[model samples]
Target: MTARPILLAAALLLGACSDAPSPHDLSEEAEYFEVSDNSNNTVPVAISLRPIKLDLEIPRHHLASIAHPYKPWAKTIWDRVNLQVLLPDFQFRNTQNLAEFNSQDSADVLRYRIGGLSSDQSFVLLSVNKEYQEVDDFADVHLRAYVNRRKYGNQSEESIQARQPTMFVVNESYLRTPSEKPIVLSCNLRRCNASMVIPASNWPEADRVDFGGTQGVRIEFNYDQKYLRQWQQIHNFVLATIASYIHYPESVL
Candidate 1:
């Protein structure tokens, strides 16, 4: 009887282990490409399901570029990077009214990349059907709400005062083009947030923009605050550069 019980317990343990989630082998399903620019700089591109939930070990070759290199590892910079195409479920006519948009069936193109020294630079460009005016309105509404929350929300006075300096405000000058409508400016003692994007930050601001007109691509990037004044130029360059990498059926342009 004791031997039989032990065997049954061993079988149950093995069964549980078998049922556990293992790394789904997607290596064969992954699409591979060589992304090259006009200047002939090339990098390997692979669109594959994330291998694991943990950080990945960075190869020694890539670590050499870091200024103050330490125990280097890699992790998903953006969770949304894996979403090659934004399906109907993810589309938003206006972020302000998410419930209404969530009910509609629409699709959008999205492309992203991790680049620059030690893979420090990254951006996600999304192409939606919405017009430039709608995008501007979305940003304007959000900016006002963000400011109001900081100024009048239930946060403690000390907390509000601490964040006051880094808070963003509209730059009247750059509000020339519809593309520039979303741009705002903010400065602390150390640096300023000067991008035509929302949700400001300090070191590497997570900036965003709706590149209006025929191609309604929304671009989001991480950049140093010092490059805020050249936001327009950066927008154009990222669009053009990323456009080169995307081929026919998958192109977001």
Candidate 2:
């Protein structure tokens, strides 16, 4: 009677919940390194983003005690180990925006959440500059890009903007805000023009060496083919991971 229908309704609701992709669900199935708490919330050990969907598998760094340099089984099991992204080398430069270090408790500095977006329709990334000596030897590099709206659905736009924090990679010359005794990363001192914006497609192919940029309000940065390839890969990987991690920390990593 009425009781029977009530039980059936409950069953249907349970089925619906089971069918939907949970936030903890990942697009792929592989060796999963899960970290969860009593709340049962688990952050993904890796993340993927963009057209390339770069894999962001973390390797457990606890193995530092092992004297063995290489182990096949260890390589297979822990090759791409899972560890927290300690301090991101990339961020945005807007407000008091020119932050230059990896320290906590700095609200002005962008938080290292898995997914952060911007009003300019761009995503921020952390990378390295091997070509330019100014940033090459520097610990990390920040890359910013506006995401094409058509790609991500409209319904997700609000979350994408508000939740996704804008990342900044500031010039080292800025005043170092001393929080927890924060220090700016010192790089090889070399003079380079910051006025020009070098298009990635027009970059020349070369070894690990960074080029100069135009100095102005709208500055341009360019990377030759060698560095371009790496930039593209890392960019895609970090972005994709951010997208997924922000949405579902448990599933992506």
Candidate 3:
């Protein structure tokens, strides 16, 4: 009942004052690493329309002789069509499909509460032989998408790697801005590919996307196999929307 008792009492009081973790926090709850922040309760919309600068060295004689369609018009159409028409259409179609799919699913396999869409333009450099002569007019944009879900708690590293969440990429044609109908060269560096692990689940934070300057719609959905399978349906719906715009060039242009 000397210094030891006094010290113990002080320690007990300090411990009582410390904040304890909530039950939910202690449980194996999934972490939400935001790709897009819900700004003021409004759906986040990011549109990046950087001026298309062609750093080409075409000869003055060739430019005058060859009837190359005005380069400005290409950028003009790309910006106008994507922002004004195509993007909104895709957004609407995707939103509708998401709502319909999520509503029917009993597993709650989607998590895009702060819903949003983004479209951007940027030049991707390619290194091919000078003789290759690939028309590098169109921009190449790579789209990779992922969502988060809780693992079954205490998963081994190997299991988590094997169970990694599937990252989806929008189909290639959608990447094509409304340009020449008969595409001279493929606009994409690679074909539009979706992750094999459908509805990719249990992804590490390293795979989290930077929604900043991101183009295209990002959907956060559940990782359940039954629910994840529906993603293909959404992808097809988006593809169809883009196809319509592509087919009816006049509508978009």
- Return the top candidate by lDDT: 1
Clashes of each: 1, 37, 9
Which tens-of-lDDT digit does each residue in 1-253 have in candidate 1?
Answer: 0111000000111122343333242112322222123322222233321211112232221111211111112211211121121222223123333343233331132222322111111112222222111112223322311221234557796765444323333333533212333344333443333322111111122111111111122234333344443445544554554444444223333
Off-target runs (Cα >4 Å) in candidate 2 are 1-117, 121-228, 246-253
- Stretches of model 1 off by over 4 angstroms after superposition: 1-219
Q: Give each prediction's root-mean-square deviation over alpha carbons.
A: 22.6, 23.1, 24.6
lDDT of 2 at 49: 24
lDDT of 3 by residue, 112-189 (tens): 211132232222232223212222122233332232233467977566444332333333465432321111111122
Candidate that scores best on TM-score: 1
TM-score of each: 0.28, 0.17, 0.21
Q: For model 2, give the RMSD to the true fold.
A: 23.1
Between prediction 1 and prediction 2, the one with superior TM-score is 1
